[model samples]
Target: MSVDTAAIRRIAKLARIHVEEEALPGLAAEFNGILQWIEQLQQVDTSGVEPMAGGGATALRWRADEVTDGAQAERVLANAPEREGEYFSVPKVVE
Candidate 1:
């Protein structure tokens, strides 16, 4: 697929990018080159290739299951709007 200046302008407008009139041709040409490269890549032969999981045959690394955030009560409530001791003192919403 060819990328024309009009298509580039429309894409830029949709992406919230401000493309000047003179720069539209350059951007369009660049996009056309990228599309051409993608087309060329699609022409490669991968019929006999097997898709790998996680891009390899390696097993997933596991970590120890442990509590990591129970000792930071004061730090966690440091920036609270209103805090009492190590906890946040919120106003009673229901009477």
Candidate 2:
């Protein structure tokens, strides 16, 4: 796909970039070059290439799934300026 100066201006506007009128031609040429390179890449054949998960074949380690209180009540509420028993107290907003 060939890119023109008008297309470059539209792209700049969509990206919210402040590109000058003089720079549009140069930018359009650069964009067209990139598209040409991508088209060249598309011509390569990779029929049966298996995708790789990572650089190595190491298995990831996982911990047991369990739920527990994040902290003891006193420790959890220690920094509360105004707390009611085991919870932080806030001003009631509802009527």
Please provide TM-scores, in order, for all candidate models, with all chains considered together.
Answer: 0.58, 0.58
State the lDDT of candidate 1 residue by residue for 1-22, as single tens digits.
9989999989999999998999
Q: How do the residues 1-95 of candidate 2 rate in per-residue lDDT, one tens digit apiece?
A: 89999999999999999999999999999999999999999998866765576535657789888897766999979998899999999999999
Name every residue pair that clashes in candidate 2: none
What local lDDT score does residue 21 receive in model 2, on the 0 to 100 scale?
A: 95
User: Candidate 2: misplaced stretches above 4 Å?
Assistant: 54-63, 66-95
Give the C-alpha miss distance for residue 85 in model 2, angstroms: 24
The positional error of residue 13 in candidate 1, measured at the CA in angstroms, is: 0.6
Model 2: lDDT to the true structure: 0.89
lDDT measured at residue 65 in model 1 versus the true structure, 0 to 100? 92
| Model 1 ranges with Cα > 4 A deviation | 52-95
